[model samples]
Every structure is written in structure tokens, then in C-alpha cells.
Target: MAVALSTVAEAMLMDPALTAQIKPYEPWLLISGVFVLFILRRLTCRALRHRVDRIGYRLFGERGLLIWFWMNAPGVILHELCHACVVLLFRPFGFRITKITLFRIKPLVQERPYGMLQRGMPQALQLGEVQYVRPPGRLVSHIGDGLSAVAPLIGGIGAIIFLYWVATGYNIWEVRLQLIRPGWPWWTLLFAPYLILTITAELWPSSQDWRGARWLLTGLLLLAGIALATLWYTHVLVFNEALLQGVASVALHIDFALLALLILDLAIFIVADLLNRLL
Candidate 1:
């Protein structure tokens, strides 16, 4: 096991592209970017709250209002599927999905509440819900729950990767960092913008999801701290050097992920305006 870990560490160290892309910035910036995208999604949705609700009401009044739910169903389904997939991955034989609520019987938040006091109210929404049985085991359960909780973000990662693959014919596993230039008509006008809005809007984790995974995040941080302390204490060993390099390489990849998310935010802003005009 030690030998295998050392070999894998050595491979991570040898990879330059992954480490070089974001040389000046810290890896934590990527984590912050993740949060920024979350806020941006909320703001974008809030801005469109009135228009979206208006469209839904106009197209299908109180009688058949589920049409709006159906319109956004693709994104909702994909988001929940990501959570389900992660649960299955960790649980294997034990996972069980209890239920999936495609639409709320009523809006999660009120539509168009006026006055400064009402501003505190959440924007109108038709969020879907998924419930499932968690697997047994403390550590395994924490990891599974954490990953499942952030499943929408995981889905966003997949969306960004799929967009990259479609635009540049590049494999994400290779850690390629080439951008699809803004001049690319097909990307700028269509797939890129659509994917950005679709993925970003679903990246918010519900409060229950966060509650389920809180300890899992704490445990990860503790483990990371230990790894850093060990690396500092073993600076003389070649294996330690490889481990440090591997960590840096992983940091760069995270930076890339964050950058992609930020770019998606920009795309969503533009698309949101276009949508407001059209719908």
C-alpha cells in the first residue's frame, strides 16, 4: 500500500499543466468562487422571479400550472439524479431512494412581495426534493452524505466538462486548460450559455443537505490539516516531496474548476438578460 501510494504521488508530481494554470492565486480562491457562484445564482433567479412567475401564470393559469414545473424539470431531474448517483456510489448495496417531489404544491417563496420588509422574503421558486436512506458506518456515511448534499455542484462540474468536450474536443480527465475563445459563434451563442444557466441555477444546496453533511466537511478539513503537518515534518523524504507536489497539482485543478464556474456566472448574467427580454 505504501509503495502504491508513493507511485501515485510521483505521477501527480510529474504533472505540470495541472499545477501551472493558476500559479499566482491560492487554491482557496476556487472554494470562494464556488460560494460566489452560489450567490450569483440566487441573485440571477431573484431578478427573474417576477418574469418567470408571470410567464408560468400567463401560459397556464392556476388550473394547469405544472407546465412551469415541467419546463425546468430537466435541470431538476439532473440535479437529483446526481445526488442519487453519489448515494449509490457510496452505498452500493444499501442505498434506497425514498421519494422525489417534482414540484411543490405551492411556491416555496411568495411572488412579488412589496416594501423593504418584504425584501427579506425568498424569491419565488419551484424547487424539487429528494429523500433517501443513508448507508451505515460513520465515516462512509459522512462522506456519502457530503457528496450527495453537494450533488448539484457535482452536476455543474459535469456540465462544464461536457461543455468543454463539445466545444474543444478535449478530454477533461487529461486536465487540459484551453479555453473556447469568445469568438467561437456556436459556443458563445448557444451551448455554453444554456449550460451555464442550467447548471448554475441548480448549484444551491438545500439547508437539509447542508445539515446532513456538516460533520463530513469538518472531518475533511481535519484530515487535510494532518496531511499538511505530516508533509512539514517529513520534508527530507522523497515521498514527502511527491506528496507536496501532488497537493499543489490538485489545488491547480480546483482553481480551474472555480474559474469555469465564474465564467459560467458571467454567461448566466448575459443569458438572464436575453431571457428577460424574450420571455
Candidate 2:
């Protein structure tokens, strides 16, 4: 009943006049949705990590860190594999992945006064790491590094979609928020949340993943500027309606996906908050 109501509401919200008015701004809305979801997801991830750590520690000891790492193993694998796949795509361009570790606790290495190395102090807990060497030259470096770094963002979306389909036998929009159908297998209910929570927990890229992206973004902006200049000079500054609508469609679905994750994280956050305060 609730799902039916939501479906109707979704249709009502898609009034042609309102959509036409907002068509040009859909891209902006997508960007804003992604940014907002990023912030909220990070907070929830941190809280859940903290709660898991505390709970594990309370149950165990230093070994509790293992629980945390394993809990995020699925996410780590997806995130790092995404990076590796993109790096491999540029392999012909001289990119090579040297090492990939899903999770490790590494010591903080320091140079002694005599130039000797002192380590093994349990410095940092790495959820995942993908070490790769990029080709020389600025353009290739920028594009290769940026794409590899942000590959998880794109891959995560694809993965979420696939997992959703596996769980519901329908695309998210088709589900219309009706995740648990009347006559579905039990595995559907079991996988519906498990797979999604595991992956979306680490769907975002860290600050380190964004290193070379600034230069790439700068390059893109410059290219866009040049294209706009050429278009205006030729008096052909026209936006492609089909392309815009296509982008809008994808963005709307992505925003919907992110919104779903956001709500789930909110519920997890509330529960974690309660746990943190209590135990």
C-alpha cells in the first residue's frame, strides 16, 4: 500500500510543466545531490565504523580491529577493484598496478637521526590500498590518475544497480520502493540490504583518491570554455535537448539511488548513536 502511494506520488511529482521548468537545472540538482549524499554518507560511515570498533573492542581487545576490517571487506574489495580496473584500462599507456591490499595495519615509519628506519608501532589501519604507477607526461597523468582514482564512484553505481536487481528482480525504478514482493524468494529479502549496505558503506572516494583530479578538472573546464567560445563565435550556442534529457534521466536515477542510501544510513546512524550512548 505504501509502495503504491509512493508510486503515485512519484508520478504526480513528474508533472510535465514542472519537469520542463526544471529541465535545465537537473544537472545542477544531480551535482548537489551527489555532494550532499557524499557528506552524509561519510558521516554515517564514520559513525558505523566507530560503533563497530567500540563494540568489537568491548567484546574482544586489540583483535577487535580485525572485526572492523572484515566487516568492510566487501566494500574494500569493490572500491580497490574499481581502481585497479581503470588503471588496467590505461595499461597500454604505461600504467601499472604494483600492489593491492584490501586491508592492512601498517606501522608509521620514521627516519631516525642516523637515517635508519624505525617502524612497527601500529601506525594506521588501512581499509584498502591500490598502489599504481602512472605514465609520465602531464595530460596522460592527469586523465589516467584522475579516472583511476574516481573509478570507484562509477563502479559503485553500477554495482549497486546490479545488486538491487539481484535482490528484487527488477530495476530500482521498477521496484517503485516495493522491495519485498509478495511471492519472492527468501534470499531476496536477505540480500536486499546485506549487499547494498556492504558496498555503499565504502562507495565514496577518500581525499587521497582525488589527488590528480584537480588538474583533470582544470583541463576539462578549459576545454569546455574553448568549446563554448567556438559555439558562440559561430552563433551556434545551442544545447542538445536529447543529450540534456538523457543526462537528466541518468542523474535523476542516480539521485534516487543516493537518496535511498541516505535514508538507510540515517537509520543506521540513529541506531549507532543509541548504541554508542548505551554500550
Instruction: Specify the highest-lDDT model's number.
Output: 2
148-233, model 1: which lDDT tens digit per residue?
A: 77777778677767766666555444456455544554544455555555555555565656666677778889999898788768
Q: Give the range of the ten consecutive residues with the poorest summed lDDT in model 2.
A: 112-121
CA-lDDT, candidates in order: 0.58, 0.69
Against the true structure, candidate 1 reaches a TM-score of 0.57
What TM-score against the true fold does each predicted structure earn? 0.57, 0.70
Which candidate gets the maximum TM-score versus the true structure?
2
lDDT of 2 by residue, 1-279 (tens): 999999988987888987788867877787577668767777877777777777767778777756756765787788888888888898888888777766565643332121011111122545566777765665776788777767877898788888877776678655266655557576875656666887786666666666545577677889999998999789686567665666666766767777777777778768866876786
Give one clash count per candidate, in the order shown: 0, 0
Q: Give lDDT: candidate 2, residue 161.
A: 85
Alpha-carbon lDDT of model 1: 0.58
